[model samples]
Target: MKKISIILSAFVLLSSFTVLNTVWTNDDPHSQLGFTVTHLGVADVPGTFNDFDAKVTSSKPDFSDGVFELTAKVGSIDTRVEARDNHLKSADFFDAAKYPELNFKSTSLKKAGKNKYKLTGNLSLHGVTRPVTLNLEYRGSVENPMSKKQTAGFKVTGTIKRSDFNLGSGFPEPMISDEVRIEADGEFVK
Candidate 1:
C-alpha cells in the first residue's frame, strides 16, 4: 500500500508539469500576406495573396517552442492592376496553374531579442523548395472585446531572390528586380 501511494504521488507530480500544446490559427479577416518588388529600378510594385492561412502551435506562453505553418493560394495574387496581376499568374512568372500554392513550415524559432525571433523555414514556391530565414515579431496577446478570447499578434518579414526560386527567369534585373520583399501580419486566436 505504501509503494502504491508513492507511485501515484510521483505520477501526479509529473502530470502537473506536462503542458498542453495550444494551436493558434490566424483570424483571416485581420491577416494579410503581402510582397513587394522593385520595378524598372525605380518604382516598387506591391502585391498580396488574398487567400492564405497560418497557424502556430506552442506549449509555452512565450511561444519559444512554437511551430509555424502557412499556405497561400497562388491564384489569389493581386497587385491592384488587372493586367499586371494576370501577367504575374501566367507562365512567365508564377505559373499559377502549375504551381497552385505556396507553403511554409518552420524548422526553428530562436529568440533574437525582446519580442523578436529568427524564424527559419522551408518555403516551397513555384515548384521549388528553399530554406529561408524571416524576422518574427511577437506583438503580445490581449483579450478581444468582441470575441472575449485571447488573441496574439505577429509580424513576419523577409527577403528572397526570385532567381533562387526560378521565378521569372526571362525577366532580367533591369526590368524587374531580382529581390522580393515578403511581409505578413496577423492576429491569431486559440
Candidate 2:
C-alpha cells in the first residue's frame, strides 16, 4: 500500500506540471506573415506568405515562458504581381521546389519591457538555417465571443539579410536590396 501511495503521488505531481502548460494554435484567418524589401534602392516592395501556421506554448499567464514555432509554405509567396512572385520562388530566390518551407523555432524569450520581448530563434529558409532575433509585442489576451475560447495576440517584427541565407544571390544589391524586413501578426487560440 505504501508503494502504491508513492506512485500515485508522483503521477499527480507530473500531471500538475503538464496542466501548467497551455498550447495555443494560430487562428489562421486572423494571422499574417509578411515581408518587405527595397527595390532599386528606391522603392519598397512588400509580400506575404499566405499559407503559414504558428504554435505557442506557455506555462505562465503572461507568456513570459513562451515557446513559439512557425512554418510557412514558400510556394505561397505573394507580392500581388504574379511574375515577381514566381520569380521569387524560382532558383534565383527561394527555390521553392527544392526547399518548400520556411521554419522558425524559438530558443529564448526574454522580456524587454512591459508587454514586449526579445525572441531569438533559428530560422530555416532556402536551405539555410541561421539564428535571428525579433521584437515580439504581446498584445494581450481576450475571450473570443464567437468561439468562447481564450485568444492571444502577438506581433513580431525583425529584419534579416537575404544574402546570409543565399537568397536571390544573382540579383545585385542595386536591383534588389539584400535587407528583408519581416512582420508577423497573429491571433492564437487556446
Candidate 3:
C-alpha cells in the first residue's frame, strides 16, 4: 500500500509540469522567420521569409508550449542563390506552384528541464507530413521592444530527410545529404 501511494504521488507531480502552453509571434523589426540548410554539408547558409507565423503552448512561458504550429510560404525560400532558390520553388522540391506553403504543427510537448523541452510535431513539406522531434531550449521571456508585450524566446532544432518529401529528385547523385537540419530561433507572445 505504501509503494502504491508513492507511485501515485510521483505521477501527479509529473502531470503538474505537463500542463502549460506558450505561444509566439513573428514580428521582429529586424527580420522575419526563415530557415536554411547546408549544401553537401558545406557551410553556414542563411535565409529569411517576408512573412511567417508560429505558435506554441507550454506549462511555462519560458519554454515550448503544449501545442505548436509554424507555417511559412514556399515562395519565400531564399538561400541567396537565386537560381537554386528558384529551383527549390519548382516542382522538383516544394512544388510551390501547387503546394504554396510548408507547415509544422505540434501534437505533444514534454519538459526536459527548467528551460528545455522535447517537442513532437508533424512537419508538412512538399505535401508529405511526417512526425519530427525538436530539442527546444527556452531562452526566457522579455518585453517586446516596439509593443512592450510579453514575449518568450526559444531555439528549436530537428532533422528531416529530404528524399522523404521527394525534394532531392534531381540531385546529381549524392549531391546533397538526404538529411537536413532545421534550426528555428524566434520569439513567441505569451
Candidate 4:
C-alpha cells in the first residue's frame, strides 16, 4: 500500500509541472513597449520600439512561468528631430551601425497576486545585458472582435540602470537619471 501511495504522489507532482508549462504565443501587432530617456539634462525625451512574442502558461488561471522575446529595430530611433535622431543612432549611444537590436528573455517568473506576476529577465541593449524584474498585470482574455480567436494581454513595467548598458554616455547624473523606466503592453493568444 505504501509503495502504491508513493507512486501516485510522484505522478501527481510530475503532472502538475507539465500542466503548468503549457502555453500559447502571439506575435507583433498584438504587443509593444515604449521607452523614454532624458537628453542633455534638459528634456524628457521619448521613443517607441515594437515586435512582441510572448508565451503564457499557467496552473491556477494566472501565469505561472512564461517567456517573452521582443526585438527593437535600433535604426527606428525617432525623437522628432532628424539630425539628433541620426546622431543617437550613431556609435556613442545605441551604435545602430553595429548592433541593431535590443532583446529581453525571461529566466524566472513568480506569481504576486491574483492577476499579477513578478518576472525576472535579461534585457540586452547595445551589447550589454542586465537582469530586470517587471511587475505584470493581466488584462484578461477576450474574444477578438474580428478574428474569433481568444486573445489575452498583460501590462508590465520595470526600470534599469542606463550606465550598466553604456547608454548614459555624455550625460552627468544631475542632468540625466541613470535609471530608465520601461513600460510594455503585450497581448498573446492561447
Tens-digit per-residue lDDT, 1-190, candidate 2: 9999999999998987775788999998999999999999999999999999899999888999999999999999999999999999999999999999999999999999999999999999999999999999999999999999999999999999999999998997989989999999999999
Candidate 1 structure quality by residue, lDDT tens digits, 1-190 = 9999999999999999998999999999999999999999999999999999999999988888999999999999999999998999999999999999999999999999998999999999999999999999999999999999899999999999999989999999969999999999999999
> Which stretches of candidate 1 lie above 4 Å from their native place?
1-11
RMSD of each: 1.9, 1.9, 7.9, 4.9
lDDT of each: 0.96, 0.96, 0.73, 0.75
**TM-score between model 4 and native:** 0.77
Candidate 3 or 1, higher TM-score: 1
CA lDDT of 142 in candidate 4?
85
**Against the hidden reference, what TM-scores do the models get?**
0.93, 0.93, 0.77, 0.77
Per-residue CA lDDT of model 4 for 4-121, tens digit only, reads 9999999998987785454767646867677676656677876665443456665545555566555678887676788977877888778987888887778888888988888898
What does candidate 2 score on TM?
Answer: 0.93
The 10-residue segment of model 3 with minimum total lDDT is 22-31
lDDT string, candidate 3, 70-187, tens digits: 8888898878789988987888777889988888898877889888889898888888998888887778777878878887777887777777788867873346667676777776
- Error in Å for residue 136 of model 1: 0.6
